[model samples]
Target: MAIRFESRTVDGVPLLLAFPDSNGAPWPTVFWFHGFGVDSEVHRPELRRIAEAGFLAVGVDAAGHGRRRLPDLQERIDQPHEQALRTMTRLAAQTAAEIPGLVRALADEGIADPDRVALVGVSMGGYLVYRALLEPVALRAAVSILGSPEWPEGDSPHQHLDAFCRTALLSITGERDENVPPDGARALHRRLDEQNPRSVHRYVEIPGAPHLMDGDQWAVVMDEMPRWLERYVLRPAHTTPSE
Candidate 1:
Protein backbone atom coordinates (compact mmCIF):
# COMPACT_ATOMS: atom_id res chain seq x y z
CA MET A 1 0.00 0.00 0.00
CA ALA A 2 1.09 3.58 -0.60
CA ILE A 3 1.95 5.83 2.31
CA ARG A 4 -0.62 8.25 3.70
CA PHE A 5 0.33 11.67 4.98
CA GLU A 6 -1.54 14.06 7.24
CA SER A 7 -0.91 17.59 8.44
CA ARG A 8 -2.39 17.66 11.91
CA THR A 9 -2.56 19.89 14.97
CA VAL A 10 -3.09 17.86 18.14
CA ASP A 11 -3.42 19.56 21.48
CA GLY A 12 -2.06 22.73 19.83
CA VAL A 13 1.07 20.92 18.62
CA PRO A 14 1.57 20.69 14.89
CA LEU A 15 2.67 17.30 13.52
CA LEU A 16 3.35 15.72 10.14
CA LEU A 17 1.98 12.18 10.34
CA ALA A 18 2.81 9.37 7.92
CA PHE A 19 1.48 5.82 7.83
CA PRO A 20 0.67 2.98 5.49
CA ASP A 21 -2.46 3.24 3.36
CA SER A 22 -3.45 -0.26 4.46
CA ASN A 23 -5.96 -0.74 7.25
CA GLY A 24 -3.52 -1.33 10.04
CA ALA A 25 -5.39 0.06 12.96
CA PRO A 26 -3.50 0.87 16.13
CA TRP A 27 -0.12 0.70 14.43
CA PRO A 28 3.20 0.83 16.20
CA THR A 29 4.51 4.41 16.05
CA VAL A 30 7.84 6.15 15.74
CA PHE A 31 8.10 9.89 16.36
CA TRP A 32 10.88 11.63 14.43
CA PHE A 33 12.25 14.93 15.66
CA HIS A 34 14.53 17.03 13.45
CA GLY A 35 17.66 18.94 14.36
CA PHE A 36 17.98 22.64 15.13
CA GLY A 37 17.26 25.21 12.38
CA VAL A 38 15.41 22.54 10.39
CA ASP A 39 11.69 21.81 10.37
CA SER A 40 9.88 18.47 10.53
CA GLU A 41 9.66 18.12 6.77
CA VAL A 42 13.45 17.93 6.56
CA HIS A 43 13.38 14.37 7.91
CA ARG A 44 10.71 13.07 5.56
CA PRO A 45 12.94 10.33 4.23
CA GLU A 46 13.29 8.73 7.62
CA LEU A 47 9.59 9.16 8.25
CA ARG A 48 8.86 7.33 5.04
CA ARG A 49 11.17 4.52 6.07
CA ILE A 50 9.47 4.05 9.42
CA ALA A 51 6.06 4.14 7.80
CA GLU A 52 7.20 1.61 5.22
CA ALA A 53 8.21 -0.64 8.08
CA GLY A 54 4.55 -0.66 9.14
CA PHE A 55 4.81 1.91 11.90
CA LEU A 56 3.05 5.23 12.03
CA ALA A 57 5.82 7.84 11.69
CA VAL A 58 5.43 11.36 12.98
CA GLY A 59 7.75 14.32 12.36
CA VAL A 60 7.60 16.96 15.06
CA ASP A 61 8.60 20.61 14.79
CA ALA A 62 10.57 22.23 17.53
CA ALA A 63 9.22 25.26 19.38
CA GLY A 64 11.00 27.77 17.15
CA HIS A 65 10.64 25.77 13.98
CA GLY A 66 8.02 24.78 11.38
CA ARG A 67 4.59 26.13 12.25
CA ARG A 68 5.94 27.37 15.57
CA ARG A 69 8.97 29.17 14.20
CA LEU A 70 9.63 32.50 15.81
CA PRO A 71 10.53 35.41 13.51
CA ASP A 72 13.91 35.90 15.20
CA LEU A 73 14.70 32.27 15.83
CA GLN A 74 17.46 32.15 13.26
CA GLU A 75 18.91 35.39 14.61
CA ARG A 76 18.79 34.05 18.16
CA ILE A 77 20.57 30.86 17.14
CA ASP A 78 23.35 32.81 15.42
CA GLN A 79 24.15 34.84 18.52
CA PRO A 80 27.36 34.47 20.53
CA HIS A 81 28.15 30.98 21.82
CA GLU A 82 26.81 31.31 25.35
CA GLN A 83 23.69 33.20 24.28
CA ALA A 84 22.96 30.78 21.46
CA LEU A 85 23.27 27.76 23.70
CA ARG A 86 20.64 29.24 26.00
CA THR A 87 18.18 29.77 23.18
CA MET A 88 18.71 26.26 21.83
CA THR A 89 18.14 24.66 25.23
CA ARG A 90 14.96 26.67 25.76
CA LEU A 91 13.54 25.57 22.42
CA ALA A 92 14.43 21.94 23.13
CA ALA A 93 12.67 22.06 26.49
CA GLN A 94 9.47 23.45 25.04
CA THR A 95 9.51 20.80 22.34
CA ALA A 96 10.07 18.00 24.85
CA ALA A 97 7.10 19.16 26.91
CA GLU A 98 4.78 18.52 23.98
CA ILE A 99 5.58 14.81 23.48
CA PRO A 100 3.19 13.41 26.04
CA GLY A 101 0.27 15.39 24.74
CA LEU A 102 1.03 14.48 21.15
CA VAL A 103 1.28 10.80 22.01
CA ARG A 104 -2.02 10.86 23.87
CA ALA A 105 -3.85 12.66 21.10
CA LEU A 106 -2.66 10.18 18.47
CA ALA A 107 -3.69 7.22 20.59
CA ASP A 108 -7.10 8.73 21.25
CA GLU A 109 -7.62 9.08 17.54
CA GLY A 110 -6.85 5.36 17.11
CA ILE A 111 -3.81 6.07 14.99
CA ALA A 112 -1.12 4.71 17.29
CA ASP A 113 -0.71 1.79 19.65
CA PRO A 114 0.31 3.88 22.66
CA ASP A 115 2.05 0.90 24.24
CA ARG A 116 4.27 0.34 21.20
CA VAL A 117 5.58 3.86 20.71
CA ALA A 118 9.19 4.80 20.02
CA LEU A 119 11.21 7.92 19.18
CA VAL A 120 13.99 8.85 16.76
CA GLY A 121 15.73 12.20 17.09
CA VAL A 122 18.60 14.01 15.40
CA SER A 123 20.81 16.56 17.18
CA MET A 124 18.47 18.92 19.07
CA GLY A 125 15.69 16.37 18.83
CA GLY A 126 17.98 13.77 20.40
CA TYR A 127 18.15 16.00 23.44
CA LEU A 128 14.36 15.83 23.47
CA VAL A 129 14.43 12.00 23.44
CA TYR A 130 16.43 11.99 26.64
CA ARG A 131 14.21 14.58 28.27
CA ALA A 132 11.02 12.79 27.23
CA LEU A 133 12.32 9.54 28.74
CA LEU A 134 12.47 11.29 32.10
CA GLU A 135 8.82 12.22 31.84
CA PRO A 136 5.92 9.85 32.60
CA VAL A 137 5.46 8.88 28.92
CA ALA A 138 5.99 5.19 28.26
CA LEU A 139 8.33 5.29 25.30
CA ARG A 140 9.35 1.67 24.47
CA ALA A 141 12.60 2.62 22.76
CA ALA A 142 14.53 5.56 21.27
CA VAL A 143 17.30 6.28 18.76
CA SER A 144 19.35 9.43 19.26
CA ILE A 145 21.69 10.43 16.45
CA LEU A 146 24.32 13.17 16.87
CA GLY A 147 22.59 14.29 20.08
CA SER A 148 24.02 14.79 23.54
CA PRO A 149 22.63 13.70 26.90
CA GLU A 150 23.93 16.82 28.62
CA TRP A 151 21.86 19.99 28.61
CA PRO A 152 23.98 23.00 29.53
CA GLU A 153 20.99 24.93 30.91
CA GLY A 154 18.64 22.29 32.29
CA ASP A 155 18.59 18.93 34.06
CA SER A 156 21.07 16.79 32.19
CA PRO A 157 20.11 13.19 31.33
CA HIS A 158 22.99 11.96 33.44
CA GLN A 159 21.14 13.17 36.51
CA HIS A 160 18.46 10.52 35.97
CA LEU A 161 19.99 7.29 34.72
CA ASP A 162 17.24 5.25 36.32
CA ALA A 163 14.68 6.59 33.89
CA PHE A 164 16.60 5.07 30.99
CA CYS A 165 16.46 1.55 32.36
CA ARG A 166 12.80 1.24 31.46
CA THR A 167 13.32 1.81 27.73
CA ALA A 168 15.72 0.56 25.07
CA LEU A 169 18.15 3.23 23.76
CA LEU A 170 20.50 3.43 20.81
CA SER A 171 22.80 6.48 20.79
CA ILE A 172 24.80 7.10 17.61
CA THR A 173 27.42 9.80 17.26
CA GLY A 174 30.17 10.95 14.94
CA GLU A 175 33.63 10.39 16.35
CA ARG A 176 34.91 13.52 14.63
CA ASP A 177 31.93 15.63 15.59
CA GLU A 178 32.95 18.89 17.25
CA ASN A 179 29.48 20.46 17.15
CA VAL A 180 28.17 17.83 19.57
CA PRO A 181 31.04 15.70 20.76
CA PRO A 182 30.57 11.96 21.20
CA ASP A 183 32.10 12.05 24.68
CA GLY A 184 28.82 12.82 26.41
CA ALA A 185 27.13 9.82 24.81
CA ARG A 186 30.10 7.60 25.59
CA ALA A 187 30.04 8.58 29.25
CA LEU A 188 26.29 8.02 29.37
CA HIS A 189 26.64 4.45 28.11
CA ARG A 190 29.41 3.76 30.62
CA ARG A 191 27.26 4.93 33.49
CA LEU A 192 24.26 2.94 32.35
CA ASP A 193 26.46 -0.12 31.98
CA GLU A 194 27.69 0.23 35.52
CA GLN A 195 24.23 0.84 36.92
CA ASN A 196 22.54 -2.00 35.04
CA PRO A 197 24.79 -4.36 33.19
CA ARG A 198 21.82 -6.03 31.54
CA SER A 199 20.01 -2.88 30.49
CA VAL A 200 18.83 -2.66 26.86
CA HIS A 201 21.12 0.13 25.67
CA ARG A 202 23.87 0.52 23.07
CA TYR A 203 26.04 3.35 21.72
CA VAL A 204 27.69 3.50 18.30
CA GLU A 205 30.30 6.00 17.12
CA ILE A 206 31.00 6.23 13.41
CA PRO A 207 34.68 6.55 12.56
CA GLY A 208 35.66 9.77 10.74
CA ALA A 209 32.06 10.92 10.71
CA PRO A 210 31.15 14.51 11.49
CA HIS A 211 28.05 16.20 12.86
CA LEU A 212 26.64 16.73 9.39
CA MET A 213 26.69 13.16 8.24
CA ASP A 214 27.20 12.18 4.64
CA GLY A 215 25.07 9.62 2.84
CA ASP A 216 27.44 6.79 3.76
CA GLN A 217 27.33 7.69 7.42
CA TRP A 218 23.53 7.88 7.46
CA ALA A 219 23.52 4.43 5.89
CA VAL A 220 24.88 3.05 9.15
CA VAL A 221 22.09 4.71 11.12
CA MET A 222 19.45 3.52 8.71
CA ASP A 223 20.75 -0.01 9.05
CA GLU A 224 21.01 -0.12 12.83
CA MET A 225 18.09 2.07 13.93
CA PRO A 226 15.24 0.07 12.45
CA ARG A 227 16.66 -3.18 13.78
CA TRP A 228 16.84 -1.72 17.26
CA LEU A 229 13.20 -0.65 17.09
CA GLU A 230 12.17 -4.02 15.72
CA ARG A 231 13.85 -5.90 18.52
CA TYR A 232 12.74 -3.64 21.34
CA VAL A 233 9.46 -2.14 20.17
CA LEU A 234 7.80 -4.06 17.33
CA ARG A 235 8.79 -7.58 18.24
CA PRO A 236 7.64 -7.17 21.80
CA ALA A 237 4.22 -5.92 20.77
CA HIS A 238 3.55 -8.93 18.55
CA THR A 239 4.43 -11.54 21.13
CA THR A 240 1.82 -13.16 23.31
CA PRO A 241 1.49 -11.69 26.79
CA SER A 242 2.29 -15.11 28.21
CA GLU A 243 5.51 -15.24 26.28
Candidate 2:
Protein backbone atom coordinates (compact mmCIF):
# COMPACT_ATOMS: atom_id res chain seq x y z
CA MET A 1 0.00 0.00 0.00
CA ALA A 2 1.11 3.53 -0.68
CA ILE A 3 1.91 5.89 2.19
CA ARG A 4 1.41 9.59 2.74
CA PHE A 5 3.45 11.92 4.86
CA GLU A 6 2.31 15.01 6.70
CA SER A 7 4.21 17.48 8.85
CA ARG A 8 2.41 18.91 11.84
CA THR A 9 2.89 20.18 15.37
CA VAL A 10 1.05 18.80 18.32
CA ASP A 11 1.20 20.62 21.64
CA GLY A 12 4.27 22.49 20.37
CA VAL A 13 6.16 19.38 19.29
CA PRO A 14 7.13 19.26 15.65
CA LEU A 15 6.21 15.90 14.17
CA LEU A 16 6.17 14.05 10.89
CA LEU A 17 3.18 11.71 10.57
CA ALA A 18 3.25 8.85 8.06
CA PHE A 19 0.23 6.70 7.36
CA PRO A 20 -1.15 4.50 4.65
CA ASP A 21 -2.95 6.29 1.84
CA SER A 22 -5.93 4.11 2.54
CA ASN A 23 -8.49 5.57 4.92
CA GLY A 24 -7.51 3.66 7.95
CA ALA A 25 -8.83 4.83 11.31
CA PRO A 26 -6.94 4.67 14.58
CA TRP A 27 -3.95 2.81 13.17
CA PRO A 28 -1.24 1.37 15.32
CA THR A 29 1.56 3.94 15.75
CA VAL A 30 5.31 3.91 16.19
CA PHE A 31 7.08 7.00 17.46
CA TRP A 32 10.50 7.48 15.81
CA PHE A 33 13.18 9.62 17.45
CA HIS A 34 16.23 10.89 15.60
CA GLY A 35 19.89 11.17 16.57
CA PHE A 36 21.66 14.22 18.04
CA GLY A 37 22.01 17.47 16.03
CA VAL A 38 19.54 16.22 13.43
CA ASP A 39 15.78 16.51 13.14
CA SER A 40 12.94 14.16 12.23
CA GLU A 41 13.47 15.12 8.62
CA VAL A 42 16.66 13.11 8.51
CA HIS A 43 14.75 9.89 9.20
CA ARG A 44 11.97 10.34 6.70
CA PRO A 45 12.90 7.29 4.64
CA GLU A 46 12.93 5.03 7.66
CA LEU A 47 9.68 6.49 8.99
CA ARG A 48 8.03 6.03 5.60
CA ARG A 49 9.22 2.42 5.40
CA ILE A 50 7.62 1.79 8.80
CA ALA A 51 4.37 3.31 7.59
CA GLU A 52 4.56 1.17 4.51
CA ALA A 53 4.76 -1.82 6.80
CA GLY A 54 1.28 -1.06 8.16
CA PHE A 55 1.92 1.42 10.96
CA LEU A 56 1.09 5.03 11.54
CA ALA A 57 4.58 6.34 12.10
CA VAL A 58 5.48 9.51 13.92
CA GLY A 59 8.81 11.31 14.15
CA VAL A 60 9.34 14.03 16.72
CA ASP A 61 12.06 16.64 17.09
CA ALA A 62 13.58 16.12 20.50
CA ALA A 63 13.79 18.94 23.02
CA GLY A 64 16.80 21.28 22.57
CA HIS A 65 17.19 20.03 18.99
CA GLY A 66 15.57 20.45 15.60
CA ARG A 67 12.46 22.62 15.63
CA ARG A 68 12.71 23.04 19.39
CA ARG A 69 16.38 24.04 19.38
CA LEU A 70 17.27 25.99 22.53
CA PRO A 71 18.72 29.47 22.65
CA ASP A 72 21.96 28.27 24.31
CA LEU A 73 22.17 25.40 21.85
CA GLN A 74 25.33 26.68 20.18
CA GLU A 75 27.02 27.16 23.55
CA ARG A 76 25.92 23.73 24.69
CA ILE A 77 27.15 22.19 21.45
CA ASP A 78 30.55 23.76 22.06
CA GLN A 79 30.79 22.23 25.54
CA PRO A 80 33.23 19.50 26.53
CA HIS A 81 32.30 15.93 25.64
CA GLU A 82 31.20 15.09 29.18
CA GLN A 83 29.21 18.30 29.50
CA ALA A 84 27.52 17.71 26.16
CA LEU A 85 26.59 14.17 27.22
CA ARG A 86 25.15 15.50 30.49
CA THR A 87 23.11 18.11 28.63
CA MET A 88 21.77 15.44 26.27
CA THR A 89 20.94 13.22 29.23
CA ARG A 90 18.77 15.94 30.75
CA LEU A 91 17.15 16.71 27.45
CA ALA A 92 16.36 13.03 26.84
CA ALA A 93 14.62 12.89 30.22
CA GLN A 94 12.50 15.91 29.36
CA THR A 95 11.59 14.47 25.97
CA ALA A 96 10.59 11.15 27.50
CA ALA A 97 8.39 13.02 29.97
CA GLU A 98 6.53 14.57 27.08
CA ILE A 99 5.82 11.32 25.17
CA PRO A 100 2.91 9.97 27.20
CA GLY A 101 1.09 13.25 26.80
CA LEU A 102 1.76 13.19 23.09
CA VAL A 103 0.39 9.67 22.85
CA ARG A 104 -2.71 10.72 24.72
CA ALA A 105 -3.15 13.70 22.46
CA LEU A 106 -2.86 11.49 19.39
CA ALA A 107 -5.47 9.18 20.87
CA ASP A 108 -7.82 12.04 21.69
CA GLU A 109 -7.54 13.29 18.15
CA GLY A 110 -8.39 9.83 16.79
CA ILE A 111 -5.11 9.70 14.95
CA ALA A 112 -3.78 6.53 16.55
CA ASP A 113 -4.66 3.73 18.93
CA PRO A 114 -3.02 4.68 22.18
CA ASP A 115 -3.07 1.11 23.43
CA ARG A 116 -1.14 -0.08 20.40
CA VAL A 117 1.90 2.13 20.31
CA ALA A 118 5.63 1.45 20.06
CA LEU A 119 8.84 3.52 20.01
CA VAL A 120 11.97 3.53 17.79
CA GLY A 121 15.06 5.69 18.20
CA VAL A 122 18.60 6.05 16.90
CA SER A 123 21.68 7.21 18.82
CA MET A 124 20.63 10.13 21.06
CA GLY A 125 17.06 9.20 20.24
CA GLY A 126 17.90 5.63 21.30
CA TYR A 127 18.93 6.92 24.73
CA LEU A 128 15.54 8.58 24.98
CA VAL A 129 13.93 5.15 24.52
CA TYR A 130 15.72 4.01 27.67
CA ARG A 131 14.40 7.06 29.48
CA ALA A 132 10.89 6.44 28.20
CA LEU A 133 11.03 2.83 29.36
CA LEU A 134 11.49 4.21 32.86
CA GLU A 135 8.12 5.90 32.54
CA PRO A 136 4.71 4.26 33.10
CA VAL A 137 3.30 4.60 29.60
CA ALA A 138 1.67 1.62 27.88
CA LEU A 139 4.19 1.01 25.15
CA ARG A 140 3.79 -2.36 23.41
CA ALA A 141 7.42 -2.49 22.28
CA ALA A 142 10.53 -0.38 21.78
CA VAL A 143 13.71 -0.40 19.67
CA SER A 144 17.01 1.37 20.32
CA ILE A 145 19.59 1.49 17.52
CA LEU A 146 23.19 2.46 18.20
CA GLY A 147 22.29 3.60 21.73
CA SER A 148 22.89 2.63 25.34
CA PRO A 149 20.75 2.48 28.46
CA GLU A 150 23.65 3.30 30.76
CA TRP A 151 23.72 6.88 31.99
CA PRO A 152 26.89 8.73 32.94
CA GLU A 153 28.16 8.14 36.53
CA GLY A 154 26.29 4.87 37.01
CA ASP A 155 22.81 6.44 37.19
CA SER A 156 20.52 3.56 36.22
CA PRO A 157 17.55 3.68 33.86
CA HIS A 158 16.19 0.34 35.08
CA GLN A 159 14.18 1.63 38.00
CA HIS A 160 10.94 0.67 36.25
CA LEU A 161 11.88 -2.88 35.46
CA ASP A 162 8.33 -4.16 35.89
CA ALA A 163 6.96 -1.58 33.50
CA PHE A 164 9.71 -2.45 31.06
CA CYS A 165 8.96 -6.12 31.48
CA ARG A 166 5.52 -5.50 30.06
CA THR A 167 6.93 -4.36 26.71
CA ALA A 168 9.02 -6.18 24.12
CA LEU A 169 12.44 -4.58 23.55
CA LEU A 170 15.10 -4.76 20.85
CA SER A 171 18.52 -3.16 21.31
CA ILE A 172 20.85 -2.91 18.30
CA THR A 173 24.39 -1.63 18.56
CA GLY A 174 27.56 -1.67 16.53
CA GLU A 175 30.10 -4.06 17.99
CA ARG A 176 32.80 -1.42 17.56
CA ASP A 177 30.82 1.55 18.83
CA GLU A 178 33.07 3.40 21.26
CA ASN A 179 30.76 6.39 21.62
CA VAL A 180 28.06 4.39 23.40
CA PRO A 181 29.94 1.16 24.07
CA PRO A 182 28.38 -2.15 23.03
CA ASP A 183 29.12 -3.63 26.46
CA GLY A 184 26.48 -1.47 28.09
CA ALA A 185 23.88 -2.52 25.53
CA ARG A 186 24.72 -6.17 26.14
CA ALA A 187 24.51 -5.67 29.89
CA LEU A 188 21.12 -4.07 29.49
CA HIS A 189 19.87 -7.07 27.54
CA ARG A 190 21.21 -9.41 30.23
CA ARG A 191 19.58 -7.40 33.00
CA LEU A 192 16.24 -7.30 31.23
CA ASP A 193 16.54 -11.00 30.44
CA GLU A 194 17.15 -11.83 34.10
CA GLN A 195 14.29 -9.61 35.23
CA ASN A 196 11.70 -10.67 32.66
CA PRO A 197 12.16 -14.14 31.30
CA ARG A 198 8.99 -14.24 29.24
CA SER A 199 9.20 -10.90 27.49
CA VAL A 200 10.65 -10.73 23.99
CA HIS A 201 14.12 -9.23 24.43
CA ARG A 202 16.85 -9.12 21.82
CA TYR A 203 20.23 -7.43 21.58
CA VAL A 204 21.93 -7.46 18.19
CA GLU A 205 25.56 -6.47 17.67
CA ILE A 206 26.45 -5.66 14.09
CA PRO A 207 29.89 -7.04 13.27
CA GLY A 208 32.56 -4.61 12.11
CA ALA A 209 30.15 -1.72 12.47
CA PRO A 210 31.10 1.55 14.16
CA HIS A 211 29.26 4.15 16.18
CA LEU A 212 27.88 5.38 12.90
CA MET A 213 26.56 2.61 10.69
CA ASP A 214 27.00 2.45 6.96
CA GLY A 215 24.19 2.04 4.41
CA ASP A 216 24.27 -1.77 4.59
CA GLN A 217 23.84 -1.78 8.36
CA TRP A 218 20.95 0.61 8.06
CA ALA A 219 19.42 -1.60 5.39
CA VAL A 220 19.53 -4.53 7.77
CA VAL A 221 17.94 -2.44 10.52
CA MET A 222 15.22 -1.10 8.27
CA ASP A 223 14.34 -4.60 7.13
CA GLU A 224 14.32 -6.33 10.48
CA MET A 225 12.89 -3.64 12.80
CA PRO A 226 9.39 -3.39 11.35
CA ARG A 227 9.08 -7.16 11.23
CA TRP A 228 10.02 -7.36 14.88
CA LEU A 229 7.45 -4.76 15.78
CA GLU A 230 4.79 -6.55 13.78
CA ARG A 231 5.45 -9.86 15.48
CA TYR A 232 5.88 -8.66 19.05
CA VAL A 233 4.02 -5.37 19.27
CA LEU A 234 1.31 -5.10 16.65
CA ARG A 235 -0.03 -8.62 16.63
CA PRO A 236 -2.78 -9.19 19.20
CA ALA A 237 -1.46 -12.59 20.24
CA HIS A 238 1.80 -11.04 21.46
CA THR A 239 0.15 -8.52 23.76
CA THR A 240 1.42 -8.48 27.33
CA PRO A 241 -1.18 -8.97 30.02
CA SER A 242 -1.60 -5.98 32.35
CA GLU A 243 0.19 -6.27 35.66
Distance from true position, residue 135, model 1, in Å?
1.0
Per-model lDDT:
0.86, 0.83
Candidate 1 lDDT tens digits, 17-61: 998666877998999989888888888888888888889999988
Candidate 1 — worst ten consecutive residues by lDDT sum? 234-243
Predicted structure 1: lDDT: 0.86
User: Which pairs of residues collide in model 2?
Assistant: none
| Candidate achieving the largest lDDT | 1
**TM-score of each candidate?**
0.95, 0.93
Clashes of each: 0, 0
